[model samples]
Structure formats: C-alpha cells, structure tokens
Target: MEKLTAIIPVFNEQDTIERAIVSVLFADEILIVDSFSTDLTLSIAEKYDVKIIQRDYEYSASQKNWAIPQASNNWILILDADEVIGSSLREEIQSILNKKSTKTGYWIYRNNHFMNQAIKYSGWQNDKVVRLFQRDLCRYEDKRVHAEIITSGDLGFLNSKIDHFTYKSLRQYVEKLNRYAALQAIDYDKITDKITAYHLLLKPLWRFLKHFIIQKGYKDGVAGTVICFLQAYAVVMRYANLYLLRKKN
Candidate 1:
C-alpha cells in the first residue's frame, strides 16, 4: 500500500489532543508538531504512539510547512488539534489514498460547532481546506492569520466532514478574535499603506451584515449572532491594531 502519514500541529490543546491523534491511527505514521505547549498536550500525544516534533510557536503556515518534510510517508494528512475525524471521513481519506487522488491535495468540508450549537448561518458552510496532499506538492503561505495551504494542481472536495469544535463558549470566541486580530495586525504591518479607516469601521459592519443576513446567521440563533459579532469585532481590531502599528512606524 502507498504510505499515508497524518500530521497535526498543536499548542496547549490538552482537551482534544488525544482524540485528534487517535483519529489518524490508520495512517502509516502519525506525526505531531508541538509549539512548546505548557500543558498536558505533549503527554497526551505521547500516549497515542505518534512521533512528536518540538518547535517554538509561530504562525499556522510556518508550523505546517515545517511539519510537511518531517512526515515519514510521501502522503500527508494535515489536521489541527481541535479537529476530529469521523469514521466516514477516515474511510473517505483511505479510499482516496488507495487510488490515484484526482488532485495534488484534497479539500475537506469542515463542520464547526460553537457553544454546542451547529451554527449554520454563521458563514461557515462548505468550509473547504486543502489539508490532505502529497507531501512534496504543497505548503502553506506565511500569513500570520487566515493562512491557507498553497497547491499547484486542481482541487477536489471530500464528501465527509471534519468536525471542528471551534468554540466551546462565547469567551473562547472572543479570545480567538483578539489573538487573531493581533496576528493580522502584525502580518499587515509590513504593508503600512494597507491600513485604512474603512477596514477599521465600515468593513466590520459589512462583515457582520454579510454573516448575519447574507449567510443567514439568524438560523443558528444566539450562537450565530455571537459568531457574526465576533467576526466583525475581529475586523475592527485588525485594522485598529494595524493603524497603531503604522503610527508607530
């Protein structure tokens, strides 16, 4: 059989590390790249029989790029610590590897849950990401926030969904917004001229409107509302932080 390896990047994810690692045991090798987590994340991962690679914290793209070459197998399945693979998804992945995959990488539709609610209207539908790929054909860009895998060949989507327990509570959502905003600010700082008032204000409102109305956040009720609001707030913070960075420079 052609070798398939699962690669996961983690940071202080003690709550979900074990499940994440177990989900990929079907692979020839399971490799986890750690960012010096100050929790039981390392210990939990160790119990799962995965090869652990330690490195300092960095952006998502950088971390994933660093992990790709470390994989022992030619094919790699990249998964985040918070994501879980259902049996259907696992079987789908195996099927793809068994034959010639249509594309250099496979994009999986992600299903994210917020506060125990499956938020349908929060603009997260058919959230496709190219995580499973031939190790030599793909790498992620260096964007600090909203990083995505870069692939040269055609893209194909997996029918099964990768479950993402993205937010356990409103607080977690807020914290992520703040963290991502800071990263985006730093990421955009290099472009100095990109910071503008519209991004700081109008764009955020528009984002909220897009999510709450265009994307139909109303169906998810409170969780959808919160998700849209947090997205808008993240937009505001990104520009605000960028503006400050520009002022300092």
Candidate 2:
C-alpha cells in the first residue's frame, strides 16, 4: 500500500478546523500548514496528532505548495481546512491506498454550502477538484486567488462529495471577495500593465452567463441567483482594484 499524507492549510478557522481534522483521521499522517491564526486553531490541530507547519499568509496555492515538499508520503491528499469529507469518501481513499493504483490524481466533488443552504446553482455545485494525487507529479500553479493544481498524468474521480462551507453571510462574501480581488489585482498588475474596458465589462457578463445558464445555476433558485450576481460583482471588483493600485502610485 502507498503511504498517504493529508495536507490541510488553515487560517483563523477555529470554528471549522477541528471537524476538518477529525474527518481525515484515518490517514497515515495529517500535515497542517497554518497561517499565524489568532484563534484556537493551533490548539485544536494539536489535539488531533497533527504535524503542524507555520507559514505567513499568501495565496492558497503558495501555502499548500510549501506544504507539499514537507510530506513524508509519496501520495498526498490536499484539503482546505473548511472542506469536509464524508464517510464514503474516506473508505474510497483507503480502497485506493490498498490498491495503490497508477493514476496520478483523483478529483472529488464539492457540494458547497452557504448560509446553511447547499447551493445548487451559481455554478458552485458539483465542483470537482484534484484533491488526491502523487506528490511528485502534482504541483499548484502560482495564481494568487484561483490557483489550480496541475498534474502530469490522467486523473480519477471519487463519487462522494466534499462539503464546502463557502460563505456564512453577505458580509463574509464581500470581505473575502475584497481579499481575493486584491490578490488578483496584484497578480494581474505584475503580468500586465493596465486593465482594459474589455476585461472590465465583458468578463462579468460572461461570468453571469457561464454560471446562471451554462452551468444550470438557475435551477438552484435564489442561492444560484445570488451566487451569479456576486460572481459578476467579483469580476467588476477585480478591476476596481486596478484603480486602487493606480491611485496608490
């Protein structure tokens, strides 16, 4: 059987980190990469026999990428602290370990919950992510806000869902969007000098269509509507960050 390591990165997630840690207890080892959290996140992680590593906050990709090299196992499952894996996914993971298949990665579906509602639309449902992978073959891209894990080989998918508690309220959503917009602005600012009206205008409309219609977000009702609107807002806000950057200089 291949050795399995679970990698989780957390920051100020005192309310959710414990449950996330407990859910993945069956792994051979759990490695937590944490930002300097002001809450009891460290204490909760310590209670679960977790090996903790401290890092300054950056992009999600940067933090997790740092944790990857430190893992003892060749096979690692990367999970966000807010993500929850159900019982069936756990068993499936063990099955894969026993088999030690040659597949380089596995994509798990994420059922996102916001405000106690399992959002069906807004292009948030059935989000598949490459959570399980061979440590040597996979690496995260260097994007600030929306970094993706890129693997060199074909991937597999797990049938069960990983719960993503994405947002609690509108304030939380706005707060996070501001942070992400700042990150995205920095990334874009470095890559390109200026933002055009094309990106500022067309991209947001496309986001709404992609989520609300193409992704069947409309079927998700109010949750989906709100998600699509917020997504469009996020696109607009990213460009707004350009204004901030320009003004500061």
Candidate 3:
C-alpha cells in the first residue's frame, strides 16, 4: 500500500477547518498550510494530529506549489477549507492507493452547494478538479485565479466526488466574487491593454446567456438564477476593474 498525504490551504477558515481536517483523516498525514490566519483557525487545527505550517499567501497556485514538495508522501490529495471528502471518495482514494496505478493524477468531480442548496446547474454541474496527484509529477499553473494543474504523466477521472460548500450566503458569495474579480483584473492587466465597452457589456451579457440558457442554470431554480446573474456581474466587475487600471496607467 502507498502512503497518502492530504494538504489543505486555508485563510481565516475557523468555521470549517475542523470538518475539513476530519474528512481527510483517512490519509497517513494531514498537512494544514495556513496563511497566518488571525482567527481560531489555528487553534482548531492544533486539536488535530496534523502538521500545521504557516506562510504569507500570495496566490493559490504558488501556495499549493510551495506546500506540495513538503508532503511526506508522493501521492497527494489537496483539499480546500470549505470542501468535504465524501465517504465514497475516501474509500475510492484508499482503493486507488492500494492498487498499482499508472496514472500520475486524477480529476475528481465536485458537488458544489450554494446557500445550503446543491446547485444542479449554473455551469457548476460539471465542476471537476485535479486534486489527487503525485507530488513529483504535477504542479499548478501560475495564475491568480482559476489555476489548473500541469501533470507530467497521464491523468484519469474518479467516480467519487468532493462536496464543496462554496458559499453559505449571498453576502459571502458577493464578497468572494469581488475578491476574485480583483485578482482576475490584476491577472488580465498583464496581457490586456484596452478595456472597451465590448468587454464591460457584451462579454458579461454573453456570460449570462452561456450559463443561464446554454448551460441550463434555470434547472437549479432560484439559486441557479442568482448564481448565473452574479457570475455575469463578476465578469462586468473584472472588466471594470481592468478599465480602472487602464485609466490610472
């Protein structure tokens, strides 16, 4: 059998830290890479038998990259503070570790929940992420938002899924959306020069249409409608921020 290490990166996640740690207790080692959280997050983590490391966070990809090599095992499972590993997923991970697998990484699907409700659509239905991977064979892209894994070997998919409590309330969602938009704007400013009306208007409208109509966000009811609209709004905010950056420079 191969040893597995679970690495969870968090910041001010006192509310969900314990649950996240408990879910990944199946791993041989649990590593909590905290971003010097000024809350009870570290206190809650101390209660567990996991190794805790603190660092000043820059971006998600950089944080995970810095933490990955510190793992005691080659097989690594990365989890977010708000995500829970389901029982079936736990068993699946164990089963995979038991076998002689050829793949270097596996993409797991996420069952995203918003406002305490499972979002069946809203372009989040097929939410998959490469969380389980060989530490030596994979690294995340250097992106401020939506960083993807770059695997050296072949990748596979898992049957089990991770339960992600993405947002507990509308306020939380908006807060995160704003933060992400800011980061996205900074990222965009590197490659983009002119932010025009097309970016602020047409792009956001297309985003809403793609999610609500093409992706069938309406199937998820009110939560879906709100999510789709807010996603488009986030697009507008990102472009607007970029426009502001352009104006300043």
Candidate 4:
C-alpha cells in the first residue's frame, strides 16, 4: 500500500477546518498549510495530530506547490478546507492504493453545495478536479485563480465523489467572488491591452448564457439561477477592476 499524505491549504476557515481534517483522517499523514489565519482555524487544526505550516499566501497554486514537496509520502491528496471526503470515496481511495496502479494522477468529481443546497447545474455539473497525484510527478500552474495541475503521467478518474460545501450563504458567495475577481483583474491587466465593451458587457452576458442556458443551470432551480447570474457579475467586476487599474496607470 502506498503511503498517502493529505495536504489542505486554508485561511480563516475555522468553521470547517475540523470537519475537513476529520474526513481525511484515513490518510497516513495530514498536512495543513495555513496562511496566518487571524482566527481559530489554527487552534482547531492543532486539535488533530496533523502537521501545520504557516506561510504568507501569494496564490493558491504557489501555496500548494510549495507544500507538496514537504509531504511525507509520495502520494498526495490535495483537499480544500471546505471539502469533505465521503465514506465511499475514502474506501475507493484505499482500494486504489491497494492495487498496483500505473497512473500518476486521478481526477475526482465534486458534488458542490451552494446555500446549503446541492447544485446539479450552473456550469458546475461536471466539476472534476485532479486532487490525487504523486508528489514528484505533478505540479500546479502558477495562476492566481483556477489553477490546474500539470502531471507527467497518464491520469485516471475515481468513481467516488467529494462533497464540497461551496458557499454557506449568499453573503459568503459574494465575498469570495469579490476576492477572486480582484486576483483575476490583476492577471488580466498584465495581458489586456485596454478595457473594451467586450470585457464589460458581452463577455458577462455570454457567461450567463453559457451557464444558465447551455449548461442547463435552470434544472437546479433558484439556487442555480442565482449562481449563474452571480458568476456573470463576477466577470463584470473582474474587468471593471482591470479598467480601473488601467485608468490609474
């Protein structure tokens, strides 16, 4: 059996840190990379026999990349503070480790919950991420948001899914969106020549259409509709911030 290390990066996630840590207790070791959270997140994490390391967060990819090499095992399971591994998924992971697999990485699907409701659509229907990988064979791209893993070997999929408690409330969703938009704007500003109508208007509309219509967001009901709309709004804010940065320069 391959030794597994669960790496979780967190910042002020006191409310869900314990739950996240408990879900991954099956791993041989649990490593928490914290970003100097000004809350009880660290305290809660300390309750468990997990290794905790604090670093100033620059971006998600950078944080995880730095922590991956410090893991005690070759197999690394990257999990977020708001995510929980289900019993079936845990059993499946154990089964995989028991077998002689050649794959270097595995993609896990997520069942995301928004406002305490399971969102089956809103472009999040097919939310699959490469969370399990061999530490020496994989690295994350240096992106501020939505960074993907770069793997050296072939990837496989897991049948079990992780339960992601995405956003507890609308307020939390908006707050997170604002933070992500700021990071996105910084990234866009470097490559964007100038803010055009496409950035502010057409792009947002297209996003809404893609999620709500093309992605069948309506099937999830009001929660899905709101999420799709807010996602589009986040896009508008990203460009708006970029435009402001251009004006200041």
Model 1: which ten-residue window has the lowest total lDDT?
A: 188-197
Model 4 pairs in collision: none
* Full ranking by lDDT: 3, 4, 2, 1
Candidate 2 lands at a TM-score of 0.92
- The sequence of per-residue lDDT tens digits that candidate 3 reaches over residues 1-249 is 899999999999988999999999999999999899999999999998999998999889999999999999989999999999989999999999999999999999999999789998889989999999999999999999999899778999999999999886688879999888988998999888677888888999999999999999999888899988998999999988888777888
> For model 1, how big is the CA root-mean-square deviation?
1.5
Would you list the clashing residue pairs of candidate 2? none
For residues 35-89, write the lDDT of model 4, one tens digit per residue: 9999999999999999999899998999999999999999999999999999999
Model 2 alpha-carbon miss at residue 139, Å: 1.0
Local accuracy of candidate 2 as per-residue lDDT tens digits, 179-215: 9988898887876656777777899999999999998
For model 3 the TM-score comes to 0.97
Is candidate 1 or 2 superior in lDDT?
2
Comparing 1 and 2 on TM-score, the stronger one: 1
Each model's total of backbone clashes = 0, 0, 0, 0
State the lDDT at 135 in candidate 3: 92
Off by over 4 Å in 1: 190-196
TM per prediction: 0.95, 0.92, 0.97, 0.96
Residue 172, model 1: lDDT of: 70
Q: Top TM-score: which candidate number?
A: 3
Q: What is the lDDT of residue 43 in candidate 1?
A: 86
Q: Model 1, range 1-249, lDDT digits (tens) per residue?
A: 568989999988999888888888898899889899999999888887788899897778888888899888888898888899999999998888888766888888899988887766689985778888888888888898878778787778889999998975677768878888888999877765765677777899999999999998888898888888888988898888777777787
Q: Which residue segments of model 3 deviate by more than 4 Å?
A: none
